[model samples]
Target: MTEKAQNINLNKAKSNKKDEFYTQLSDIERELKHYKKHFRGKVVYCNCDDPRVSNFFHYFSYNFEKLGLKKLITTCYKSQDMDLFSTNNAERAIYLEYEGDKNGNMLPDASDIGIKQLNGDGDFRSEESIELLKQADIVVTNPPFSLFREYIAQLIDHDKKFIIVGHQNAIKYKEIFPLIRDNKLWLGFGFKGGAAHFINKHYEDYATAADRKEGMIRVSGVHWFTNIDLKKRHEDLILYKNYNPEEYQKYENFDAINVNKTKDIPIDYDGFMGVPITFMDKYNPEQFEIIGVGIANSGLEIGIQPYKPEHKYYRKEVQKRGAVNGDLYMMINGVVTVPYTRIIIKSKKL
Candidate 1:
């Protein structure tokens, strides 16, 4: 099939699938209502979404209007019907059908409100998207799972506020865990019971018996992530697992521990304090102290060896010889590195 023809088909398929997902919105309406209450009188951006298929639209569109939301910006991979959200007031609602190239390359137009759509895959990694993010007060959408890292990073980089949907495992992503550790973000109220309804790939409302249902399948757990306050509307469950002292003692020199997977934590240790990566947001410098981090890789060590002054003078001589050199020197330890997991020392108060 031609690229245009395929795009048309894909657009239809996505629209249908999103419509099916909307059927489940009623189950989550109460929580969504609370989420929307926080966005009253605010400009909301829904990137990588069609309003019809979006929970943000299905649940909060009316509330947004009632609360005097200044604007509602929604975009799709291709221009399609968005009449469902059309209101008489142009200031309150606007929809854009992003046009992509023959190869499916598209960017968010200058008129586009929030992050510029880059690569047209619905991920928020484009330069324009980052710029739009700077203006946003809150983002509400179900972003593509593949680009959750980049999406969250852009939000953090610009310090933009957002409410996004993703998988539960996203809490364990090396990049995401730190945000929680530093108290910059936290988990939403949902996903406490372990399973949520997501529209299946066959466009079924729920998982069918015939679906493969294996690792990284199309059908998976859908979670909500946001920095917005839900106003004490959540059930208190142990979001962070407790650290086992037995386990910490076994891993010496580790002052504190964050158990992304509580069940997998080691056994037998002293002074090993455990908390979930979500605790990053709750991290108190007076309570728990971070010591150091470790990375497990041989190739990285080998690649930087030449730049080490003690190992050889090749790196220094290249600069001295004017071999297109700059102030690039590889050091063994002075540099600060970000780690997936770090051992922190807990204060007596915590």
Candidate 2:
């Protein structure tokens, strides 16, 4: 094999060998307990995992047998490692062949009802995977960070109940944020601190060197986004404080100020309602509501402004041309000019 291929293989080997370093946290355990009760005598699927190194198995193996799970499905792209941990009640659990591995010959135990190996990926998007998703009462696993968006889309599309692990920033995505806003999702308990170790194939010596020093493969704080009950563990942090119309009138150049009110405000306003960033979390169609949200700088006009660079040459050219008044500038990416303004809006219902 080529050197690159050899390296990839070596990395996979190392990850498999050291997989035990990763462990589930208490909050994850609590969530699983809730799941077991809710999905008693139902099938559960763990997508994007090796049965041996899977967080799903680590957390739920004992509980599965106790609850008499109908089936536990796990997959691997290359080899089946489901035999690492043996459960006494093997008859109840079944292993199916993933369709992607045509040559894979792993078979489920006789006690298992049947085999259902089919095509799938770390992202869990295959016909069999979709079928498993449809059949499962709950999906619990740590999906690959690379394809988190697509993975979430599948769950939401199917309207399945799931408790999955992902980067905390996933909550900030435009697509994801709306779900939390609409009360279709919520952040789990123990989100403030983060979760356990995640040993992986790409353990770069330098890129992850700092995290290594800290004794873990640290990604951004891992959080649980779910339609399941999270028990409202974390205290809600307010986004806006001391909000008043007079405080914002001076910065009228901006379009609006986003404020998160601690207490619910009256929605009986004639104008638009500017919900705070926190409003994204509590937004409910039946109760609270959202009109719209975007970049609105009250100080400057809603157009862009371009200024010459601070270099000596640029400054000289600017002096020669005289200071140009506000030139229309192209807003790129997340950068935007906001007037000393706050998001303002009117609310009615509550």
lDDT of each: 0.45, 0.47
User: Which portions of model 1 miss their true places by more than 4 Å?
Assistant: 1-23, 79-135, 201-222, 230-249, 252-270, 275-350
Q: What is the lDDT of residue 313 in candidate 2?
A: 32
- Deviation of model 1 at 295, angstroms: 7.8
State the lDDT of candidate 1 residue by residue for 44-80, as single tens digits.
7776566545655544444444555655666543323
In terms of lDDT, the best-performing candidate is 2
Assess the local accuracy of residue 193 in candidate 2 as a C-alpha lDDT between 0 and 100: 33
Q: Over 4 Å off in model 2, which ranges?
A: 1-27, 33-36, 65-68, 79-123, 190-197, 200-215, 233-242, 245-255, 259-350
Give the worst 10-residue stretch by lDDT in candidate 1.
82-91
